[model samples]
Target: MSVLVRRAALTVVAVAATVLVAITPAQAEPEGGTKPLRDALRAASQGYQDARTAIANAKKREGELSEEILASQARVADLSAAVGRLAAAQYRGGSSAQLQALLSSGSPESFLDTAATVRYLSERDGAQVTALKAAQATLARQRKDLDAAILEQENQLKELRKRQDEALKALRSAGGGDPTLGFGDLPANATPAPRNPDGSFPSEGCSVKDPTTSGCLSPRTLHAYNETKKANFDHYVSCYRSAEDGGEHPRGKACDWSSAAKGFGGMAVGAEKDYGNKLAAWYIANADRLGVLYVIWFRQIWMPGTGWRSYFGSGDPSSEHTNHVHLSMR
Candidate 1:
């Protein structure tokens, strides 16, 4: 075949292969030795994140209510003082003073002016009283809401503790012996995922097309993947596997970033380990922004509430996650 014809044929074959991957059902789980461990990590991480969001929302509401209550209280105090002064003036003046003013008027026009002035003072005092009442009512309502917010914060704290305990339990069951000095912080930035008005992540589906694989990813996962590339950590990445593969991969809420430039390889060491460390630190630093559930790298895992714990999977690089950084999103 001519060179031009051969190039066209190869292009067609590549397109066909991509289509096949897109349509192919996920039949087997990836990484055979780590299914149970991945499952536990997902459960613990997700629960901790939910509790953390709730607590943050409750704290924000509490702060707002507090500010409003302070303003309301100040208004009420000022109104009360104004009303008190009006009452004192009325008591000191008494009816005698009004009658004397009317008697001293020299003409009908003068008497009419005195009467009008008396009515205006009474009406003004009444309005002040009304305003004071309204301010008090508003203050009461705000205090009640503040109380409820406090209660909500307390309840969410309890839930947070429960989730933390569950995470610790998961670590113990997974043979994670103790906390380790995990990857340290490195300066990295990621575009924040869109959130609900209350600062919670919006529920998403496997809708966006995964760039690395033909499978699909949630919009959040896709954003995280792109942001990682922007940070110049681009290596090999695969996201959106079959749900049958387990954990967030099938749900399109996770990605596996290989340390090797080409793909997954043997245990990452030296520069490769450094790469994984930086990547893991970047995810942790941007966890809240990206709604990260957990990050697993180099035999350690980081969750929302639980910082870092030893995580050893069945004896293999994939299971141990020594060769890649695993990121799971909320």
Candidate 2:
């Protein structure tokens, strides 16, 4: 090969080696083949939220500083007006004003008091004006600092969003935009999850008449939900949670049947584990017909073609699905 071509090939090899070194085995293969990418996306999302909060706080502080600056300016103005009037009167009448008061005094003590009052008033006004001036300067500096902080926060948010988008792209590549990735080869008849009559899952099901979310659910999700209710399972089966603001839950396409009554935690090793497993298996078995996208239970995740894989959530049973059977649809 020519010298130029050899150099070009060497550069490419160097870049490839750098990438291989930077990406760990877990990242290359990913935990459960996709968890690493999902983890990256989650970190990025949290960073975005943090950056937004910082920006909001900075703005609030900036507003407070502005108010302080305004109040200080008013103080300085009032001080100036009072001092200015006193100065003008002194300049107009000069020492004669004090002499006139001194002559009107009926006694030596009264005359001395008139002269002392002039000196005391002038000194007090001067000291107050000086302090107000310093305070105004301090307020201005504080406002400037807040402005810089707000700008910095804005820049950080922009950068975080860029990273968030990159993480999402990597996650999409790892999961192929499909929640059902692990249960093995797709059936020739496999199809997308069922959508609502209006296309996206929404509030309406069983009787849409119930006010609390416990009554609302997507029609297809409700089918599985109603079935679980009858399974006489050891755990409570719940659907249509109203607390969540986003994702499949609020949309009525997800449900959580948890054994933990108060909080999410590991289930007792015997029947609870068995119940969770059965619930998971049932969903996987009926996935095709029921439009199931994925099932999470017993600290594992199952998706079409991907089979069962150990789940690594944020060290929480709720997140790991260890104490609950979390089901989601298309």
Candidate 3:
């Protein structure tokens, strides 16, 4: 072969090799798979840590609340004692010979003294009763609010524990497995059979589709996802739908659910570069049973890559979503 032709052929072959290496699916448990799993594990671990912290905080609050209740009880007791003293004084004054003598003296100064003394005793009794009742009412409200807060904290801890268990299970299952495998060792060239874009599942149900409408998922599918993950599927769907439909997401844009399982768009990175860590966490916990893997927000507007890291805040640039959750499967 001519030198020029040979060089051109070599260059083409090198380029092709690079592309194949880049696009070829990695082995089971490839770094790609492991990365997302690790990220999810980290997030779950963090959640566990947070739950522990919250429990501690709740305990502290309970202690403080108990003290408050005790203090309120003490105040009530004090007020009751004051009322008793006032009652005794009033009773004595009303019947005492000294009071009677003052009233009968007929001197203007003596009569004035008796009237003042009676008024003072009556006012003091009324004031003590009012103060006691007010303290008791205040304590009741504080106790109720504190009790509710404690319940909420307990629920949060329960959810955290559930997620932790799932993460641990995944880690165990994936042990010594290649992290780069897509869809549990499925071939990378295996394109999923096309389905109706309207978001319906196939009869055999190897893959599931999400509705084009914001936040639409079949009740069965939602139940399956929630049951598998032991997480709040409804809340997730609600949040996604709200974000997609609230006028910010352009019409006709739908979230990509399958990408989540396939590790699309460098999704494996958990530390900071991973844009969809929370979404991935949900997917990892639910994907096995749901046949769903990823979710994407479909929109026409361009979102700056700068803000992808904030999972809970206002998405990219728009705030139009007000309802619904997106789902995907592979």
Candidate 4:
């Protein structure tokens, strides 16, 4: 073989702070506006599309590799059989060499000619054996490529699931409604949880700037953050233009309370963990009354219908939401 097609072995956020994150319903809009959320939703939706494309590509490659593997196996079997036939012929001829030559040869020179033929056959067999070995090597490489492609397909599927999960979550949070149902921000019929007489949270003690637009947070997020402030917890809080906006922060519809002693990458534990648990519970307890979307803290996320569940992501402290409680408004 002039060219041996070689198969290369294919080797394949902490959250801190008093974060009060919110999940916006699909088809609903933040009181602030929809521009930022729309952009975020678009991005999330795009991610899902990309994942699907990647999975498709992976599967296609897997199929091609599988075909190539089959071809390689067939070639190897054929070459082995060819080599076997050559060896068998050589064995049979060598077994009857003298006797067969005497029966067919015209004279002693015929014996010499028969010996030469046998020698030529032996050389051909040796060459066939070499070719057979080469074919086997090629088969081994193709099988390796096939296995790698299979693994790649599996990874792509996993990625597709993750992206789809996140995209669905984002769509629901962005009030895009259910994309599958072609609805936008559908309204809920559930009676809202009550508020204080003054239309404030139960404590009615949190303070917020009046304007709800521009750089100001939406009403619900502001209320949640203010609740933290009103508690006199001596904690630090920020509501707008966070690095991880995804629409809520920059649009001023989200608030993240830094729950960690350190920032961003800090892992919350011990007292920090307790604080996050209590805060998350508080938000869940007040969700309906405050128009809260969702709450994320301590490596977990909780929304209205679903209870607490493990939130998997980049696995960093910030990604885990262990450093803060992120709260957003609808």
Candidate 5:
């Protein structure tokens, strides 16, 4: 009887195992019975990777273009200096005494030679001035083109980030456990505010000096910068207003701050000082609350250190801010 019971128990265990194997749960399928979303997300990731490559290429191109622009500018400056010297010489020759010295030669051939030399110098001076002007114009156009390209690449990067964020969100939503998974844990109500009438923000009041106009600022860009500043400030205030809240604060401008530097009028020392100080003060005021370990802004391109520190009478502090949180609004 004991042997019979042992065999019966083994048979029952095998039958249960077979039933469990035969009735396995179905694998989960994503929504809509289509795999297009997953495919799209993969494509978007690839596109983001491509965008990073494009950004690197754009930066290299910008550097090359900037070097060319500088070299061209230096050539123009040299030509300008040469022209100035020649003009001074011509002016000195205009005096009656100098003219007499040139003309009152021992022989006609000597006088002709002196006259020919003066004429040659004048002709060369004129040619140099013309060449300098042409070079300046060409380099100015090239710089403008490079600036536009940099802006374009930056915008493309922003778009890529947006798409990547969306892709991540879609993947998380499809994966199903937490709705917020893969969607960066943003505040529940983190929607950006609409632009006010006149396309300005109430919190922003700074004006961007105009490069084109003599003393006036660019109203349009000034307004835009102010709005961006306000928006960034608002984001920061919203995120880190309290220690209990675990949100990220704004660390940089929404768009490229370097672009606004162009509208800072001429290369006046005081204007740069004032703008730099204001930015620094703003950072300092919210530094602790915002958890901003470091903030860097490269006027020309992205670099290792705090561009602000260099501006603030400090040695290069680029490497020091590496451990701090990195936030790039642009």
Candidate 6:
């Protein structure tokens, strides 16, 4: 072969190797064959996270209301004291004090002055009484609001428990025998995804372009992908695909991080297994901030409420997720 042609061939091979390390080849079916279980996991995970967020918000509101009630009570006490003083003055003086003062007045101007003073005192007492009533009413309303907030927190806790149970049951029904003490010594924190004003993740569509494939991914998924890369787990990843089986793939809210550099192969072992473990643990640690619904890796799955449950996939590497870590986003 010519020297130029040989160099060109070498360059093409290098490029091919790089591409293989960056993405998996397109396949007809999704890796795992647990569509029903995945769907159940998604629903349960989302509900559980929602319940948690609601409970947090309710607690914050309860604190605010409690503080307001305390302030209102103080105001009511001060006003009540002022009103009591006015009542005591009226009781001691009676109308006789005013009449005596009017009788002693030597001129019409002095009589007018006394009358004006009495009128001013009467109006001030009435205003103080009105303020006391208003303060009491405000305190009552604040107490009611605090009660409602407490009730909401209780309801959300119940819902969170319910969702946790559902997730556990779904896994068990699909042959999840017991929880696994998943990977340890997780990597450091990832950059958080954008959130709404209230600290909750905002709704996202399949908006951003997928870097691995000529498809699209939600902004949250892309953020996860970028963070994973930043964590030095830059293996082959595939995020978006049109699957008839119905999962986050079609919605651009999922990504599969291959354990092997060459692509999805046999079960990851040794260093590759360690790589997958660290990646999975990182996702779990940052699940709340990343808007992650669930993560499946090496025959185990992690959801929000449930820590890590056994996951039984079809009898293959892809189905078992033994060679990749699958992430589903909310």
Off by over 4 Å in 4: 1-43, 89-116, 174-180, 183-330
Native-referenced Cα lDDT, model 4:
0.55
Please provide, for model 2 over 134-211, each residue's C-alpha lDDT reduced to its tens digit, 9 standing for 90 to 100.
Answer: 866876787778679778777967866675565445445554333333323322222334544433323344444222
lDDT winner between candidates 1 and 2: 1
- Candidate 4 per-residue lDDT, tens place, 114-162, comes to 8787677668778878988988888788777778867876886677566
**Which residue pairs does candidate 6 place in steric collision?**
none
| lDDT score for candidate 1 against the true structure | 0.82
Residue 112 of candidate 6: its Cα lDDT?
96
Can you tell me which runs of candidate 1 are displaced by over 4 Å?
1-40, 99-106, 243-245
Task: Itemize residue pairs with steric clashes in candidate 5.
Answer: 210-217, 305-318
The candidate maximizing TM-score is 6
For model 1, how does the per-residue alpha-carbon lDDT over 1-330 read when each residue is reduced to its tens digit?
Answer: 999999999999999876554323231124333567567667777777777788788889999999999899999999999989888877897567878887899999999999998778668888999999999999999999989988988998888788778878867876783888988897646889899987788999999999988899999999999899999998877888875557888889888888877677668999999999999999999998889998888888888888988887666677788888888898
Candidate 2 error regions (>4 Å): 1-32, 93-96, 99-106, 175-330
lDDT of 6 by residue, 119-164 (tens): 7877888999999999999999899999999999999999999999
Q: For model 2, give the 10-residue run with minimal summed lDDT.
A: 24-33
Q: Candidate 3: deviation at residue 12, Å? A: 7.3
Cα lDDT of model 6 overall?
0.84
CA deviation > 4 Å runs, candidate 3:
1-9, 12-60, 87-102, 144-146, 170-330
Best by lDDT: 6
What TM-score does structure 4 among the candidates reach?
A: 0.38
- Model 5 C-alpha lDDT per residue in residues 1-330, reported as the tens digit of each score: 699999999999999876554222110001111245434443554455446556666787788889888898888888878878867876776546556868688888998887887677657767888998898898889889799869978887796777556555544454421221110122222223343443222332113442322222223333333443653532111111111112111111212122123221112235443443334344433332332222332211111111122211012212111111122221
* Cα lDDT, all candidates: 0.82, 0.58, 0.43, 0.55, 0.41, 0.84
How does candidate 1 fare on TM-score? 0.83
The digit string of per-residue lDDT tens for model 3 on 198-257 reads: 333333321233333334444334444444344422221221233221221121112332
TM-score for every candidate vs. truth? 0.83, 0.43, 0.40, 0.38, 0.41, 0.89
